[model samples]
Target: MLKVKFNCFFWLFLLIVSCEKETVLKEPVIFTLSSDSGFIGSQLIITGSNFGSDKNKISVSFDQIEGKVDSVAVNKLFIRIPEKLTVGAKLISVSLVDKRSNPAIFNILKSYQVSTVAGSGLFGTKDGNGLQASFSQPEELTMDKKGNLFIADNFVIRKIDINGNVSLYAGSSTYGHGDGATGIAKFNQRISGISMDDADNLYVADYRFIRKVDLNGNVTTLCGAMNASIFSALLGITLVDNSLFVVDIGQIKSVDLSGTIKVFTGDGSFSSVDGPTESAKVIPFKITTDNQKNLIFTEFSLGSKIRRSTTSNVSTLISKESLKLNGGLTIDREGNIYTVNGDTIIKIDNQGQIELVAGSVAGYQDGFGNEAKFFKPTGLFVDGSNNIYVCDTFNNRIRKIAPIN
Candidate 1:
């Protein structure tokens, strides 16, 4: 009886050990995915079991499209979603050896699309240019808080409503310097640059004058003379706080609401020199303000350069190399500068790295991003959504570049 009991106890101990080993081996072969939706070129993380340690042996597929494997471990894998995948639902799976994990559903985000927002052809006075908008040498443009666009069209400043109706905001058909109501005031010669203050009033620089037009169409000449020491043929204007900055043939000046004028840059001579306000500036074009309220402007001379100025009236050249030929400097929220250089849109980051953002060849063709062409494009504006608005000068149209998020 004793021997029988010992045999039974030994057999029971072996069975219990075998059950515990089975439990350890069975750890649920089920694996889990991190996310169900992602955008193109986005990195995705996947957690699973028995994925193996070799990255080369690991393979991942999204909607039958192979993803670039970034890392792989025994229980986790990382991959970058393929950029070329179509925008829609996709099946994602991970394969290791002959064991393929269960497929998961992933949705790709929508891509960007570029389109023409205003104007149809070169110099059209007829309404119904794309969105009931017309252009006759539209130069400078600015958007209001409501998304309405204000454009400087030759002798008159036109306002395009959100519904695309074009109407005169300031200036008349015949050009002459007169400060009155919007319907009575006239912009002599040609209007160059424009900016708006928090009060919804627009500050316009026309020829050798800087004028202010309020929301009710009241026009007031801020501080500029026909041929005074302040400016001569002003081309750009930017407002910071209570001060307004203007760029003319070779000078940048600041104007206060009280009509006080101060030369911040240039000695009224047209030549490239890096120094304080006593030095010369070579044909400065567009002017903008960075987050720090520093005045940034672009030059159009053969060896053009972008420069910045402090409120203390000190000037500093930002680029070591020449900008060569550029137009319309605009800054994003992050202080990155965007301008047009020889038919291509160039972006200069805060670190001073230059990159081409749009325009493939110099011509007149509006397609997708870099694949699109431009004709001496000038005026550039970035909206809150980062859509780039380009004033295709020679083409006589407002083109938009929408980025794929």
Candidate 2:
């Protein structure tokens, strides 16, 4: 019995040694991964270890993507995510047989936003896509409290709400030709511009005709004597302290809550003989109001444009710094004004300093975004995210420049 027991013990000890040797000699596969975290479009890397060349042999699990993923490389995996992923963190993991790893994490960021200059002469673009291949001729654009877009088309006026919903505020398509927006086939009798006051009432200037549309789309013709006429093109209008200021020819006309008219600029009519010779600049295109109640506007025809009291004592915000200015202008929450000068999007500081944010997108019409050429850029507006929205007229699109950070 003792001999048998000793033999069994020796065998057990030998078995333990063999198992230890086998455990230490096991082979391992190499694997690695990295991610670029700050782009709506991003890439993930998997390198160093056991991965099969066959696309079917590898499997990946991301927070929102799963697949026999496209192999960007043998070691580098390129992942193009959806735009909606911008609001969340993404984690990716890989598994082969029973071996698995903790997920690699990344945060998605907004690449850009979309907006249009009020009356930049370009609409949201067809297909309702602000960027895609689309068609729209916009006269003006404004945003409501909910980020809904109000655009004045040459013959009709439409509203694009937060969800990309478009409803007609006014349309001439159903009626005989009359002076209004959204349907006037001709600009001479159309709603040249539209806006909303602090009271949330929608105001539209139809050539020489001024009217207001309520939230329910009911239209009421406002004061016409102050706005009606041939030379009064009723191009741009802004609201300040319960008053509406309309830009006609070279003059800025003020209309009050009571429908009273007052001449704020030029000779009060197209009758003013100014420009080049007179310090009085006429034919300024769009009008804007600063938080300080100062009237900010732009002058087309490539001349000097500045903001001053009705008496012309102040300096110009849109200067003749030799830029061929056209289209729309906007002042941001920080008091910085953005303007379109030729094909350039110019950012002017509160101190009157200027910087070229994006320009000349037309030169890069090839869509390469190089040289930033703009074909007759018309409108400019910015969102809370600091994304710049440009109305590229001839391009017939609204392009958004999102902050890269």
Candidate 3:
């Protein structure tokens, strides 16, 4: 992974001041302008300049609708185009408070044929920061309640605002924490899986521990058993009725913000021991909650499946089939269950039916015009707007699936 580190301001300042070569390396900026994968929007970034100077004063216009600059630095700026330009690419003009630039043009590529905040990250590829191939991996991704993007690689988690500029949220080569896990764990201890609560507070399930993180990346450990069951590998989490649901092997456990644990179901084990010969069943991969406050879980099998029951009774409801090799599972506000298997995305109605929503993608290539397709998919989630965000894992892209008109 080639790590490209630059300040978002240096692009605009164009001012190079040399210190001890080490000091100049601290936090500089880098700037660029490009269109999105679907070409419906342009992701404009201004780096190497002091962007966070005035939050309210930061704004961008695509010569179309108004776009608010999400994050600014001495090195980068991220902005999104409007929904009107869903078909073709266009030239985009970006302006800051005192700096304005001409149209910077580029082709937009689709992720699994879906529009999302993370399209094919080829811009950072042909001329990139070093981890070009990794961006194409789409490994682990999360979207905040407001629809911002957070991508996790080997040692880093990036926070991407609506405007599109991505900043490093966690991880490092020598400082901060170790890069042993795919994502950041809570309290900077064990690295495990990631999730956001209803209030958008970040939660990480590291090994057997669960911890809360503040906006500035501060972590506070909450729950974990030192010598616990296989259920300690918390893969997914969902918040409902003022409680938190965790998905491990063989069961869905409920924990409160105050740190209490209750086994909702299973023989009391996780993936490592989910089998009868072992302890429980096949491990639970992801979990979600419906609008009715019911807990639902997705597990990998020949035909992927999800089990639902009353939170208080892992003993109450029946376990239903969801999909094969399910990755990420989430329910929309309309009570629809969404799951991803391989490159296929499916939607299940409340009546227990499966339907192909989008992403029957067939090929893998860094696309420019119309040659883009989906590859390995890892993370999947749904926003409040009914827009589906997919981490096209292998293709190093994040795809968004919208209803076709």
Candidate 4:
């Protein structure tokens, strides 16, 4: 009886050890990612160890947003980047059972997927949400740090929140010049350009005047004079460092914070000549600045061209024959230039190579890349995430072009 009992105890101990070994799982470990950066929907290969060959048991995420796991192996994982992820650096990780792999950093690049963020496609001033909102020939637009977009809609300035709600931000729609509260202030009928500073103070180019709107909704005339010959017709406006640059008829003018106006570039003649800053003549329509503070403007004369003005000299960056560039000019963080050519959006790289970003023929259809359409797209604003907001002027809508996943 004692021998039999000993045999039974030994078998029981062996069975328990076998069961424990079978149930134990090794924690997944990540060695490296095939690539550190890519656009949405792009595939990424994760290589590591202890990632078992069971695809159903593996999970992946980017910055806590779940990503699709295409395939999985013991030492490799194929993942599809998820959609609607905020552009920039994202932390990627893998999971198996209850254990997560080491986190890795990945960068999401800006891709194109066009969608209308506001406006009803009708010409009016009614404000609401999405299609419920209406705009009257919207032109220039700029966004604040909080993601609230301010638009130059006809004679009034409109605001659209990140949730797609639209309302009047400034200007009373009276089509004249006046300085007072936002609701009581009046802007000219031709409210050409708008820009915002780091403090959320808005600077607008209304006809021949440069107006400033404070955070308290108070409006004031920053610079420009109706009878002043220095400004023929104020078009585009951009803020760089301590100066605000404005496109005045055919010249580029700079206005200091105290409202001191000076000719920054161009000879104020309707011609295209690249030379010294004061001697260069460009029929500029819109103006913006790059990361290096280089003033970039679109020359509407002598064939459509994009020019750059340094501290003391001006040079032509891109020249296309009979392109008829619009007043839309924006630069990405990478210094790439985005402008409008008739009904299409054109992107110019640092090498001066031009590429079509979106739109083909004029219409009002939202799609991806060339499939998207814009009717006389005007002002463009690129946010921190590299997402672009376009003033689809004739469409009377504010459209967004974001990375597609």
Candidate 5:
């Protein structure tokens, strides 16, 4: 009986050692992961032993959420952290068949949130009912660092607080340019574009004038008088670095803090010709600048264009085609261009691929991407947090597209 028991134990030991060898040889090993904590949709790089060359055989997951594998190599795997995941520690595991490697711990974070905070209508109305209030022909939208949203609604500048409270920040009911105290002052003319400087002061393009409004609602004409020759009409405005890029009647002009303005682009002509600054198409509608100080603006004449100014001040047409990209322009941190192309909001990625961000079928629905609809959506503002606030014009409301969380 003792001999038989010893034989059985020997066989068992051999089996255990063989199983260990198989595990060591066949199981994929994990050495390093890019980050232990990241927001949903963050790109994570995992590296180390034996991820395998055949990506089809491998699988990765965060907690119960399956990660979208961007790419896979023999020893490295690129994964986009799954979206809509709860914020907390999640077990990250990579596996091939039954050879599941030791799990790693990753923490998921909250990302940008997209929602409609105001307005509800098939065509929009100026309800003025606060949180559920609506807008009337909202043109330009800008945001301060403190989360306050400002809209150039018709001739008035309205403010939507962080808590979604709406109130008239500047301008009076009556239209026409009038610079004075807060409520008494009037934006009697049309406001084509509006932007905020580093100090949170607003630069408004009111027909023939560029007005400045302080925190206390003090309106001051920054540049361009009622008959200033510097601009025929100021359409789009953007504050970049320390300068303001304004789209005049036929050219893009750069104005210094002291109000000294010069034609930054446009060959002093408003034709559709693309050439050097002095010969480039001058009639620009909306203007925005990138981190590199490159001016981006849109034109709707001849071959409609989304033009960019090169470092050497040369004009470069960027939009895939000549489309009427009417309305506000903003660029993301990744250099993606977000603009209002009529009723739809389109995004031009760094690779120049145009994709729809919102507003497809048109008319108000206020749902997720593609599912959500807009009526003549125009004016876009991207905050420091990458939240996209859109002026749903015909809907008379501001819609926000919070990035993937």
Candidate 6:
């Protein structure tokens, strides 16, 4: 009888322990989120009960796209918004083992917000903030390390501070070729492109000449001259390391600080053959560099392609019949290329995937993503925060595409 009682007691104890374990492993329940809406790469904090302490066992997803868990606790999950999610309301859920949490509605904002940073939408040289400022054919844009923007505005170089204040950085109202102080120096009517170096010095493609403007706004001719045969037409200019690469007519040329110019790639032919520098032929325009220092440029012909020139050879990165590349080209810190096609801003990822970031029609309107409109948006610059600044040439305004707050 005692043995029978002992067996019953042992079985009852086992049943109780099993029930307790089941109670401990409860389903995750998300009660609140730090933010109900955010952009890609923004952090979101999820808080609720019964999430459990094991991060490996906890999984979070936004509309089935897995989010990166930055940190985790039993009742709280800190995660980053996942990329490639469609911009709209998405169901976010947390899963613990076989049990899933209640779905929470979270709105995903567009990757960028389009707004006018400066320019009065009129062609003039007035310098101020917001709509108080004006630009005359703003061509190319380059931002310094401190977030100050320099623009190649026809006959002068204009500057926009981080606070959106606009002022003339270089050149004079008189259109001519002269190198002196910022106020005294004169850039010809054709100021094609501008680039900045580590020292905040601006290297400008002033027609056939490459001019260097020091931090103190002193302009000096770096290379090329009226009588020099080294260049047919100076187009896009970019600074990679100690060398300045520029697109000259149908070829890519590199100019050293000592004013020495050499053929970096291409044989001055307009063909699209990709090979070693001697055998390659490219009709290059709007040159920039990737994180690997590989030269990237746009070829307006051959179905509008983006090509990369490595030390070994040149190759096509992206080529599509639908691309209408008419504006500037730039690369973000992540090596993603930002360029304009017609009135739209396009982003090409490292994997060659193409996405239209903003704008769908040609006009002058500011909104988000496709709702925005730009008229002949030319120069492009992606700042450290991934905010894009555009020279809306025909609109005569400098537009900014920034992250949603």
Best by lDDT: 6
In order of appearance, the predictions have TM-scores of: 0.70, 0.60, 0.58, 0.73, 0.70, 0.75
Q: Candidate 3: where is the Cα deviation over 4 Å?
A: 1-113, 119-140, 174-192, 225-231, 269-283, 312-323, 365-372
lDDT of 2 by residue, 270-389 (tens): 332333322454565777777687777776454646454443433455556587666777778898887777777777887888766565444423221223466676656566756566
Each model's C-alpha lDDT? 0.75, 0.59, 0.56, 0.86, 0.77, 0.88
Using TM-score as the yardstick, the better of models 3 and 4 is 4
Lowest-lDDT window of 10 residues in candidate 1? 23-32
Ranking by lDDT: 6, 4, 5, 1, 2, 3
Candidate 2 lDDT (Cα, 0 to 1): 0.59
Query: Per-residue lDDT tens digits of candidate 4, residues 1-405?
Result: 999999999999999999988987878998999998865666889999999998889999898899999998669999988877876999988899999988999998655788999988999999899889999999999998889999999888898988989988888967788999867999989689988898999999988899998887688998767775657888889999889999887788889999998988777776889999988887888888989988888876678888899989999888878677975889988888888999988788888777667787989988666668999999999887778899999999999987564
For model 3 the TM-score comes to 0.58
Off by over 4 Å in 6: 1-110
Candidate 1 structure lDDT = 0.75
lDDT tens per residue, model 5, 307-387: 787545555456445465877789988888888887777778877777666666767765555556777877898877677
State how far residue 331 of model 3 sits from its true place (Å): 1.2
- Candidate 1 lDDT, 1-405, residue by residue in tens: 999999999999999999988853212132666777665655788886767678887788886779999997667788988877887898888776566778778887644445777786658555553645667767778888998777777767777677766777887667898988766888876688888888878999888888888897678887777775556678889999999888867778788988788877776675766555555454577888889998888876636577777754445456445454466878888888888888888778888887656776777666545556888777778878877777777777777777774
Off by over 4 Å in 5: 1-114, 120-131
Clash number for each model: 0, 30, 57, 0, 9, 0
